[model samples]
Target chain A: MVAVATPPRGAKRKAKAPTAFGGYWRRNQLKLAPWLFLAPGAFFFALYVVAPILQSFQISLYEWDGLGTREYVGLRNYEELWWDDAFWTALRNNVVWLVLYLLAIPGGLFIALFLNQTVRGIRIYKSLFFFPFVISQVVVGLVFAWFYDPTFGLFNEILGVFGLGPVAVLGDPDYVTYGIIAAGLWPQTAYCMILYLTGLNAVDPEQIEAGRLDGAKGWRMLWYVVLPQLRPATFIAFVVTIIGALRSFDLVSVMTAGGPFGESRVLAYYMFEVALSEYGFRMGYGAAIAVVLFAIMMIYIAFFLTKMYRDEKGV
Target chain B: MPSITKTRLLAFAAATMLAGAAMPAIAQDEPLTGELRIFLDTSNPAPRAAMEGMIARFQEMHPDLDIETTIIDREAYKTQLRNFLSANAPDVATWHAGNRMAPYVEAGLLEDVSDLWDEEVSRDLASTKGSMTIDGKQWGVPYTYYQWGVYYREDLFEQYGIAEPATWDEFKAACQTLLDNDVKCVSIGTKFLWTAAGWFDYVNLRTNGYEFHMDLTAGRVPWTDERVRQTFANWRELIDMGAYIDNHTSYSWQEALPFMVQGDAAMYLMGNFVVAPLREAGLTDDQIGFFQFPSIDADLPMAEEAPTDTFHIPAQAQNKEAARAFLRYVVDAENQSIINAELGQLPVNSQATIEDDEFLNAGFEMLSSAQGLSQFFDRDAPAEMAKAGMEGFQEFMVRPDNLDAILERLERVRQRVY
Candidate 1:
């Protein structure tokens, strides 16, 4: 959007003795203004984000309690993580979150397609579907925790109708991660639905009409015609869902605090539990976990960036 | 120089008089001036009022001192402690005793208040002196503490024809009877992890005795040691019997209370703090009773869990003189009695009178006679070890079959932490 025009070299010399400083500023302001505008963001990005990442790398090499003098223990933390079962559990849960969380994409698309209609109460239905995303995640976690309560939860009550169980989903290690993931997927599905609903509004109607003329109906119509049109929306949904899955901390914190014996812990929550929680001040170990988590995130982020760059180049 | 000696002499006389009477004529000889900042974590309404009232009384004693008090949320205070201790330390700050203060002490954040723990103070507060001591120096002074035991519904025990069990077999029989009556034996919540640690502490203390438990926490003994395994075996009896409320991992300590309150569960092995909520939940003295966790080995001297809350001067404090004076005021037997009476806890000072309340008196009696007082599992163990140990306890409670795996995991963590 830069509209700044360069003055002709000859016209610059012919201009009536513009002050030396003013002339220099006029020449360089276009080149420098963008950098000037970017300074605050770059400064903060370095200070808050980049600096901490680098510091975490440094801190990961030491044995420090976040209080005492640092004792350099190079690579020991990571070596310990190799044998650490809790670390592996957290990493495994993150993978489970990544895989199960992707269900939100198709789940959202289905809801979006169902809701894309001319109906009297469609708006009300749409808002109702969007309600979960609007509330704080803490509230969502609390609601779902109560919903899964063994003795009084709705899940058990439904199970009781068939004489199944008053099983404690959060108390069972095998089910704890899945239970938290289900809680996470609720808001996430709502989020993706909103994205797809907006995408549906921008869909080209003529393409659908052409598909209909060719006898492309139902699943075939969605597959051959409408799906390509929603690629951008799907891309956005995938991006958010994957990142959301990776940084799944709040729900786990609120629901169980990595209970059922740390079964529900994601890397993010485990890192905090190790670093800042009352029972943990193992700064070096926590930093090692953070660095591993960062490395995992960087892989996805780098891939996304490269894909975005290629798309921008129309490749 | 002579005037300084006179001030010291006057302070010593005041301290001696405090040992005999209610309140010392404090700060009388040498008035403390400048600002004295006190940070407290007693954010709950009653303890907050008790502390503020105590500080107000201290302010009255030193009217010239500009006393500033900042009360932080109890949980938030824990993580924020390191930050403030290093960055913007107050003259004095409240903290817990035992290894909870170890990190701060090792980091040189806390002032060594060995001088404050004088001959008289040492003898008077001797019970908690070990908890406050680190590396042969006293880092702080404990103000209040409370006992941990099985708090049961008296009516339910009476209904089942059960007396307070004083032996392992009796405790098990009591649990079995309660279970046959369609009642859970104990209502524990391991959601926060420390509640399970409470059970571990008692079992270990009763199983192998206090010294072994302390050594195990200190990393001198391995987690997979036979003694440690025996402690787990004892705990497994309760778990295998399904004595605890169902789905306990889903509930907080407070959330587990309703089981006992509603008589769905017969007892709760918790700290004396549970008494307040029990009383508030409409349970009367007739309905509730306190008993020591029964002896697993009659040969072992009885040791009890009593987490002590303490105050320390930050090493970086600008007003160390005023802070030391404030600490003396805090541990004065009469002041401790007043504060703990309001707090519904036991005063650390030996001469301090227990509150007339049934629970407080029971806690006081139980603690006073106990051979050793543990600072709970979480406090006794190092921070990282405590987390791993407590998690293992929670796991063992849910899946008793996983005991071997859990002990191995804790052994690995214990190796790393130490």
Candidate 2:
């Protein structure tokens, strides 16, 4: 901003003058300032995120084995994906994940409401409730896996008390994906709870008090006054939970590795299994799978961005 | 390919001359240099300790050479090799033998190590050569492998007055007798589909002999072939008898061991690597005993499942010489003996011998005398086909009545994958 204000230092040589540096700096400084600030983040974003995405699209068109010469097979990889049963299973599982994952929002709000009251040891209770979110997803998956174990797990043990036989939740293809998603929900619900709790704290007590004066309390007060104020938090919660569902990789990976005949597969895990695993590296095929996942994420991202844009314009 | 072969041969000959002029210990004269990065999965404590010991010894030998090792969880390790091997490839990596290595070999990720095999491995390690060879060339050097057979609870058998079956009829009858007395006849964990493949390999190899099994695994034969159907038919009979531990699919191979250990179930058809876990589960040597998988189709030659592990230099590695040195050092019978001793597994090198433990003796005998050794099903078949085949196998185990449907589905996968 001050490049124009500073005079050139007493010129020693005419051509070697400081005018060039200052002139360029002054003329472009404002225009370049924001970009200069964004450079590091933009550079990384382009390098890691953008480049790999374009590369994945490119790789999907070829029969490349990660190494060696790539054969340009055009849409053959995508063509194969059309008939791929595992792809369908994974896609269906992802849809199920998305639909079920939204439960976290209401679930979180309910939890936040339950713990929102001024009770003794509430802070401790909040932290304890948010404990699952604090732990890594890998650990949560393992813990849940142990809980769901057929012979020795607590779930089965609990069932035994009811004179019910053990349930092989992880091993049965019918229940495997749901079993993993339930585990995913444990942590996800915790995360949404934290978001709602903070959102709840920022809620206007005056509006709540006004609502209470009109006989609004419990669910009605929360719906009419409290929730509207928590819109930003709800929006963030929805976005993250959707992403968590789509990126439902770790839980499936840690708990199942897409087992029981690929019944538990999400697109991400299926891609890994196809391109890597003990299977031959059909990188092109894997890339095709990734491209499909990216396409899906793009739809969500587009929807999210458009919704946010409209909200921003309105506000 | 010829042009590459010529250039590689020249480089290899130059390397050999350098080796000859150097000290007998390759690294001592060359003062080994460059990074020798090895990615392996040794999540099992014994094997992990054995690998660490091996690497420590390797470091002591080539103190000047920088070494990097990444040991990953076994399952995760399976998913990352293709990624790393393609980009910033490591100098050395561990891989399985048989059709499992075919994709990497075909994609040229693994260096052709036939020269190293001839110079160091082929003579003493002939038994393992078949597993490592692809298109008449060796892809890697196998260091360790163990036998797969019936691991039974001897105490349970004795208590129930059941004799160890040696023939197919006796095996079936034994399952019937055990079921009549309320004991699950077999304990298997098919949670990781490959464990189901273990059962498939034994049944296929026993019913159809090793050649047909290999053909089937190689995708040369259709899954609906009469022989394959017959194998499943036999498997169905066992399934119908409720011979296997219930809900086998819900447990990993390790998870299934508890039933056998607790004497609630009697037998496990598993690789000998499970010995460690079984012992960890508190079953003593006397309580746990092994028998060869019972013979079926008496005219068919006997074969055993022995999946071997190998080390290979990636084709793009910068440290070929150092990696070659590692391969040579690792395949040496003495080193193999030391490593496998700690691993509680048998070394692939012929001259490498295990101590006189009863199980080891039985395992060695079982593998050695077999007419052919089939790498367990997952290792024998291309990963894609193996995966589909095993899934079908597992599904069939659950619903034996779906035999035709399962075979048809497997045929579709085999057609596409092969």
Candidate 3:
């Protein structure tokens, strides 16, 4: 002290101490701060969302009618699925749905690129393109149904102008699923287009200039420069499109109801039909179907999570 | 320095807490009041409107009680009803009778309305009490009972020189006559699976007696029995003779009504509800007429499908007394008349006057004179069996080539249920 503490090497001067409560908060903030902010939301999420999911999982193993003693059926529900051809057909259709629904991405990107411009009335065109997404899927399904009506629908009427015979799009089993998928893609494509337009606005002009100097233009420019920058947008678009495809219930229900002899059934509609429809209340069996679907979804989710983890680590 | 101000703040907080503690007591001394909730399946406009009118009247009667009602479509009704019942059930709700009510009844979710039925419903009427009674105890009070049979166009029948067939052979001949006349013999909408179930029940019931039909539905009879085989054989005969419409799976019952109304189809096997749409299509009562389903066996008695609509009070209902009072009031002759007048349904109460509406009168007559009444196929059969049986019927109708496989699959389903 007499020697002025010798001004020890790399030593700093002491600052004023914080208050007791503030000091405690600062010391533990990394651990406690997150919980403090998340407490209310976590409480609600646990009560309404997480709890019900767990409850559903528990209910899946028991034979219950939403009441009475829930008899534990173990794997019998899954065993029944072994021979359930309809379940297989529905699963196959869902696979088809997941594959075909990806077309919405490119289709949406193309539309987005086409509409992303400074042309006159471009805003109105964008708004018009977004109209279908704003309307309820139920209404869209009804409109599409009327449009596909063989006898008097607008599509057939247009065909009639070209001297082609009427085609029963909904009535033909082979074409019914495609018809429903087309209707779904209408709104899905609109959604994707909006996403891409936003992604395009955030593109780095400097990077584009560098690419141009490097002789990158047209498809080459898009592939190496524009698309890499649009990764976040494409990621979000892919996730939403996958979820939408997996949950394609409304259009199928409204337009065909998995009908034409159950040819249009996908997993979501088929599960509801088996579980709660007038047909039967096979809750356990329905749960088995749901679990299978969840497992398939989990595979995609794992892949997505791995990619996100690598990106987060700055790989 | 701030200690004095802190004391003043504490005093203010204590005063506010005391006021909050006293507020509930002051309000409780005023009145007893709360909300009453009801849910209904609103597929048809007439019944929905009639129900709304009834609810409005109820609200007017009980001004202090706030009533909330939720009307859902037919497809969503089952899922929503199950959820509501499990979580927070309504005071009263509309549900189908027979096997459809069995699961809920078995779970003890539905309140026992036997006391109300016995005290309020007049037993003088034959059909009123019978439809709602299950296991010698009443679980619900039926408001309407409808008859199911062949609704044919008299103009088409007359033009084709065919009369209403009394037997299966005659019915086939009538179909042949209609086909020869270039009119579709029967218009069916199998797209809604329940429509095809009507044909299955008619054939099965006509071939077998009511008791046998019940046994078959209750999983007591093997589906491989000769009676079952014979029913399919009879159905096969009709299919081979081209007795039904082309592309039946593509149409709904409402869509098919036009074919019958326009005389493009000779017959439509459906419930009495078809009259509503027929009238909407500008068909007069004389143009559309009803006939009992033709008998498949000469020896067995004819039993027609008569599905009933009933209301049940939930077991956990807080307003049980009020719900019972409402039930008693609605089943009374005055309310029955209002219901029948608006809904064009047959009144369960025999004393209720049939409106001058010709369709209602015909439905009343058909329901009153039927030898026996069986609940519709889907209602009479357990839910699982009904689904398989109905799908098999649809498949057979579309591809008669798969009759054996269809029958075998049905037998397997029937066996599983037993």
- In order, the Cα lDDT scores of the candidates are 0.89, 0.85, 0.79
Q: Residue by residue across B1-418, what tens digits does model 1's lDDT show?
A: 2432343364445435534643323564778876677888988777898999899999999898878787887767887787778865778999999988988998899999999999999999998888888899999999999999999999999999999999999999999999999999999988888899999999999999989988988999999899889988888988888888888998888889999999999999998878878888999999999899999999999999999999999998767888999999999999998999888898989999888998888887888788887898888888888888888899889888998998898888888778
Best by lDDT: 1
Candidate 3 lDDT by residue in tens digits, A163-222? 995776876667888888999999999999999999999999999999999999899999
Best by DockQ: 1
Q: Estimated TM-score per prediction?
A: 0.90, 0.86, 0.85
Task: Give chain B TM-scores in order.
Answer: 0.89, 0.91, 0.87
> True contacts preserved, each candidate?
0.92, 0.77, 0.46
Off by over 4 Å in 3: A1-53, A159-166, A202-232, A278-280, B1-38, B49-72, B119-122, B125-131, B240-243, B355-369, B408-412, B415-418
lDDT of 2 by residue, B206-287 (tens): 9899999989988999988998989988878898888999888777787788888888788889888888888988989999
Question: What's the CA error at residue B90 for candidate 3, in Å?
Answer: 3.2
Per-model DockQ against the true two-chain complex: 0.60, 0.49, 0.42
Question: In model 2, which runs have C-alpha deviations exceeding 4 angstroms?
Answer: A1-43, B1-40, B49-71, B83-92, B117-121, B315-326, B329-342, B352-354
Model 3 Cα lDDT, one tens digit per residue, B1-418: 1432343354345435534542221332343234555677856887788888877877787676557676777766765666556545666788888888887788788888888765436463456576566678888777777778888898778876788899998999899888888888898877777899899888888888788888888888877788888888888898888888765776778776667776778789888778787888898877887888888789886667888888888786655656676677567777777876777777777667778866666666766666778888888888888888887788778777877777677777777666
Q: Give the TM-score of candidate 3.
A: 0.85
